[model samples]
Target chain A: METNVTNIIIEKVKKSRISEVDFSNLPFGKVHSDHMLVCDYRDGAWQTPRITPYQGITLDPSAKIFHYGQSVFEGMKAYKDENGKVWLFRPDENQKRLNISSKRISIPELPREIFMDGLKTLVQIEKDWVPTTPGSSLYIRPFVFASGTGLHASPADQYKFFIVCAPSGPYFAGKVRVLIEEKYSRAANGGVGYAKAGGNYAGQFYPTQLAIQKGYQQVIWTDDNTHEYIEEAGAMNIFVRINDTLLTSPVSDRILDGVTRKSVIDIARAEGITVEIRKVRVEELVSASKNGSLKEMFGAGTAAVISPISGFGYRGSDYDLPEMKDSYASLLKKKITDIQYNKADDPFGWRFEVI
Target chain B: METNVTNIIIEKVKKSRISEVDFSNLPFGKVHSDHMLVCDYRDGAWQTPRITPYQGITLDPSAKIFHYGQSVFEGMKAYKDENGKVWLFRPDENQKRLNISSKRISIPELPREIFMDGLKTLVQIEKDWVPTTPGSSLYIRPFVFASGTGLHASPADQYKFFIVCAPSGPYFAGKVRVLIEEKYSRAANGGVGYAKAGGNYAGQFYPTQLAIQKGYQQVIWTDDNTHEYIEEAGAMNIFVRINDTLLTSPVSDRILDGVTRKSVIDIARAEGITVEIRKVRVEELVSASKNGSLKEMFGAGTAAVISPISGFGYRGSDYDLPEMKDSYASLLKKKITDIQYNKADDPFGWRFEVI
Candidate 1:
């Protein structure tokens, strides 16, 4: 297996694209690396994976991914430490979550070893794309989608697993101003809420755009039935600090089980801060704001890291949270990144160093 | 404008793909006829559309459609009668509903005339593909997705509108047995529940697959908070017939405003049946079954027309709904199909004949 893998790598290097590309002035997702990893699924098995130059793929209009939304993805960054070594932070977690998402969406499972191998090869081949500039890194997106040509509403027989790399930046331009949507929701019970599926993201566009029209950066979606409980923001797990207690929506079938969400929970515990994970009703937050108990709020995700919410409008009432001098969000973000960049001790064994 | 359009069509046909070929056994969505209609939003304007052959187009991986859940679609069918005529049932309603779904999802709208003209041309091009046999027609899928590539959680400045046709059979093979999901929901209030967004379908796969494992056809999702109010089936709107009245969930933002659902309501009215459109609690349904008031239940959608429900299981209790016979569901299905296939007078003006 090792020698075959080495031969595949040597072949990939021989087949690298001939395009001379400037890394600077590169837009987030515009400039692609020289090589990409492609794997095929047919006859109920994932065939031998191959690496090739970035190119267009032909798909039937009825391919299940385009029609049925049978697709899921993960976003992780490749960081270059001071020693010129590449490190991936808890990528095994992403691979596991991808499988979890696959199981929920009824897509075939991807073995962890295959997933890790694909990621390692793609990153190694595209090492030059990783930016050493401040607040910049290579953004790697691993996705799986159904690729069959039948139109019926069933799982696809053929699937494609591919890894694509993008030159990076802050996902959100700056700080965000969100609106707590009291009416619309993204996912619900028995829904694909916990998975990083494409459909879950697709459903949020119109409503989040509506919020954008109203001058909000994102919409904090509430529960479906009464629309009373605060579930999550569009891309991040939400946290509201009330009276020194961090309150957040409980992880359920209707919300994505975010890795950053778990990290925040752990960081809070490590800092001796009280964190409550239960159904945080929208009314409770409003009441806390009125009572002057609400101190700060932020959103946590892998892409944006930690985005502080400046203000939120709920039912047309604007509520601005007070800024904190010693914010848990900023603290956790630093601690996590420090560990990821190998600048701090990996007390939690979160960082996996790749030599 | 009309003359220019006619001349353009004639000239386009002069240079189109080789049309004289065998097209039987096309296999669902694999084959496309000569022309496909595509319109784009560029410079904040929806440019006039063009019709071209079905081909693969490439996009940046960061396209909002790929990353966010900003995609929505509608399923509508066109049929041919025995007298060598083509007709669409409620095409106007579908166009309007598509707009509604677009508005809810932040997608650009395809003008009514453009939509109708595009459908007519494509159906005309594939008229041979529309089988004239009983229960055979061409399935039309009109969908819009954000086309810009960026990792930001904002609505795309650009959008693409595409209408593709498929040769489809009955969606469900046999009488469907549903599992009443007490823990999951398909849509929620203040959510895109009533919109035919792609994410809404993706969310149902896991639970419905579980239902399939349990020997059920689909999972009937309930309202998210309490799982009390019945929302809809995976792809179709649900209807339950109590002793004499037809009880169905009210059309709310949390339930899809199915075109067939409203048609059934009109058919029930025309048949002098009492139709109640309100929240139908799960408990009330179970009680109705125990008391023999629940005579039958079925799902209404464009694909299946009306799919009868054989039974449902919920909360450790199994209830068997009798296979419908000489029932309102069957009668409405017939009356509705009459207009769809142009077999009867379209008193409701539901059928639009294409010249």
Candidate 2:
């Protein structure tokens, strides 16, 4: 979707936080950039989008989002290459997914023009916050929430859409450990699992907390019906590299159509590596691990780009993957970052230059 | 749970909106009471509860509730009897359910004293806001949400719990028509369907809106695995009276254990009516409607004590239930209200008098 960035109303920050930020000690989603974009939806139409100073906004305690959770969000990143050029990776994908999530959550679908225009303007304004440090970028969070003051079970009449950016480092510190969830399920067969919705993440916290107590940083969620098939690894889509073949679970109504996951599949196929997208069974993974065919297991999402899994625990047993000299995770992470930082050729034309 | 009301720090509203309220024309959840209770959870313990004027509380834009839906809430009411005494119906049940929801959503469990003391103090102080009109009460909403500023998938370190009251009339206006959902599911087996979490309600808004467009007031949500069994009607637990036996869906991980549903079952049994608590199939309900055995159908919840179902739409066909004098819904509504308003003997000792 083509966006007219000139339409954004700018309200620069009175006092910049850039001087205070410690780029070497950045935390994920804690520090905000100088400006944010706000758009209000009321009377069946979206108001003019405005880029304002990043600050707190008051909401009624009875807002539907507070009670019923009618909120949808998207996560993307803005990068600064070595040449000081600002770029956004696959932001159009995030805009499309946000509308899909809005439909699932009964929120009004944001126009592509507004989403793109707001995002580009906000990122351009906060370009300095785009850390030059490796693995760090401006983590852009564009979210829409119900803002009306009522407690009915239906959709809210008013919505507030905003694009907020935070300067962040890596999502995960290092190689992560995951637990295979057998009891608690993230999304159901006919539920809003595929949607990047607020409730979907909220429901996973308890089970995820339990996994954290068990010494795992994340959970590899299985199907709700039998817990026999793999679905996702925490918030990211999972991929299993068995020998020379790269296998990931196919996107379904219950699985998010991740941008990074799709990119990896395309990149692996382009690189002549075998890519299989199908329903992956838990038994198959365990057997492959036992037989030493499970070369590596990694998670793919916008936050980390490629989160290499060290090991996974399931049903009181742990399986560890041995270190490899040439791993797919490292290769793909390099390839993606190369295009993002403009070091390598953009074969897929995935990078969008902001300035 | 025993509550120590004397420990609450009360700050009365300086200027009450009592004179501006129109008791006879009350709308659900729009008008709030004068006072509200606030309790913060930080450093692993609940802070001292404080009562203040009903107003908006500022939250960081990066609060987990905005992005991850880490929130849970309970809905209840405080009825004013003809003698001007306020009474809470089985508040212990609400207190227990809130903590249960908290556990499911990874929000820290609220202490029994805090839940009870907050509710009692808020309702007592807002007694003037409780309408005298029949079918009207002070709607009490107790909610807990992740208040910390961050965008992690894990649970929040800081939380906020609030008890807010609104003057609301009946939740449902007249006899309601419902549609049997075939595609979208609210909750799944082994999911957080049993908890009154924000996500559970948020996920239903889209589907519920579709049902509304189809001229139905609510949707009778079916099981996620198969749309073969009837699970719930809107936000309430469902019951179908076939001949003499009152059949309702058994509480599972996918179905909320509603206070009014349980009360109806107990009241029906006490009145010598057979009550069957088991799995209720959709086919059985349609067949019962075809035959003469389908006596009545109703939804039970705190907001609407007993909402009678006029008809239901399923599989491109609509089935209507015949109106009957002395229907089970009416009988139970009167029975429950009688106990709630202190007009009859409290056989179950469910009433908790606040004044």
Candidate 3:
């Protein structure tokens, strides 16, 4: 793809931080690349995008983002193929979703050209930061926040858009246990749940912490109106495989429309698997667990790609799934990762090469 | 009242900005005082609180607060009475609620002594900035946000607490027209709606903007599940007066325990007016509005002690409230402000003197 890089202002770092980072034991979301993309929206338009050295940002103490949670972000990853070429998995999807989130939070939508050019230019400049390891990649964080100085309860007049990169290993280490939450909700109906709004994630930390204390790695969030339906798992969209059929909740105002989630569905359907996109009742899952039809459960997102679930706790009872020699989790993860890492054929045109 | 100012570190500004501010026409939350209080929580404890010149704060681009919305805040006021004495109305309540909001969002609870002493000392120093004009005062914003770098979608290890004051005029100019929102919601049951989390306010802006475009000043939110019951008005706790009785929704996990709300209830009850705290159905409001029994409607909060609603839009129809010669809104507002400004005797010990 030919990116319009002429419009983006580039300021390279004096010294690369790659030498200081120990990639062998990389932590998730801690280490950043040498440069970052920043754009300011003020005076009714987005300013020229700038790529500067990764550093701190200064804002007034009463910035709207600090008082009102008028912030939105996206998660994507850049991969390195065997031949040293850099690639981003469905970068357009992330750009689209970021604007969707921005609009929901009352932020002005970012222009597509700026988003694409800024992202591709930054990733190209820092292509060396893309980890060469088998399961590791450079995690890209594109976020926009209210930068207007005010304490009034309204939409901000100015906003700051940022794209920061972190090279890291997997989000979840291994197979995980999840608690089916009966109390507390991540999003509400007619709310900002579908958007990648910052508040959506903040509200989940406390409840997930409670689940972690109960010997669970994450919480499988249910609908706020009734705990009968399953919605999401932690920050990722969840999929439940009962017998030969795969089930996941439909995207609504209360559930995020994750990028990897749609890819998984498309890949699964192309592989001739039955995927049901509807509300999956907790009662059905509990019954399936008792009857031994629950084969596998997993979460899908940019950070994890596909995180297999080992077991789940619900209604004071723990249910474990039988280990399958030919589990769907492994098959789907390999297929998706193959596309992401540019190891397989790009049938769906999902890969965007940066270099 | 005596305060322990021994623990706080003070750094005065070289010169005051008071000369530049137009106190006669001060905008809400835009003109800030000369100094602000800041405290950092790290290494498993809150550091020494500092009162420094109000200035811009620098943070990492990857700070968790920018991405996850792990932020909470409180609204308060420092009122300068006729004798140049500053008083805070139920500041202890604001302190308690701030901690409550912090805990719900997984932020560390602020110690009571620090919150009290910091607020008192800061207000004392900036007392000259507090507007002595009628219906105008210095608005104090006490807020805490995640300051830790990294975006792994968990609770932040470091947090920043700040107290920024803005010398402002009244929040609302005149009676407002509110839209009874049935399509959008501010919060859900078992959600972070009750807390003054930044995300809660962020979600309301878009919906409120839509209402504004439709000729309404604010949105009267309804229950997320059914949209059949009244919840709140914009950022305030709502009250509906039917005939001679005042009806307000009970404080639950979804409704804020507003300081002004409770004060109005107490003052009204003391004045022998009937006050009912229960779930108020939208049907009841509509019926009362049709029957000419809906005498008054108002919103109560720190910014606006009482914002009277002149009319409301519901289901494609608008209902104009009668102009009562002696309305409950005017009466309660005067009684509350009397206590806040030290013009009336305090029977409930709601006023805390800072001078």
Evaluated against the true structure, the overall lDDT of model 1 is: 0.77
TM-score of each model, paired residue for residue? 0.91, 0.98, 0.99
Reference contacts recovered by each candidate, as fractions? 0.53, 0.80, 0.86
Per-residue CA lDDT of candidate 3, range A1-355, in tens?
A: 5548448888998889799998888888899999999999999999999999998999999999999999999999999999999999888898899999998899999999888988999998989999988889999999999999899999999999999999988888889999999989988899989999999989999999999999999999999988999999999999999998999999999999998899999999999999999999999999999999999999999899999999999989999988988788899999999988889998999998899
Q: Taking the tens digit of each residue's C-alpha lDDT, what string does model 3 give over B267-288?
A: 9999999999988998898899
Clash count, one per candidate? 15, 0, 0
> By summed lDDT, which 10 consecutive residues of candidate 2 chain B come out lowest?
B1-10
Candidate that scores best on DockQ: 3
The prediction achieving the highest TM-score against the true structure is 3
Error of 2 at B141 (Å): 0.7
Q: Name the regions of candidate 1 deviating beyond 4 angstroms.
A: A1-27, A226-228, A242-247, A271-293, B1-35, B323-325
The models' CA-based lDDT, in order, is 0.77, 0.89, 0.93
DockQ of each: 0.50, 0.81, 0.90
Task: Give Cα distance to truth, residue B340, candidate 1, Å.
Answer: 1.7
Runs in model 3 deviating more than 4 A are: none
Model 3, global lDDT: 0.93
Cα deviation at B200, candidate 2, in Å, is: 0.9
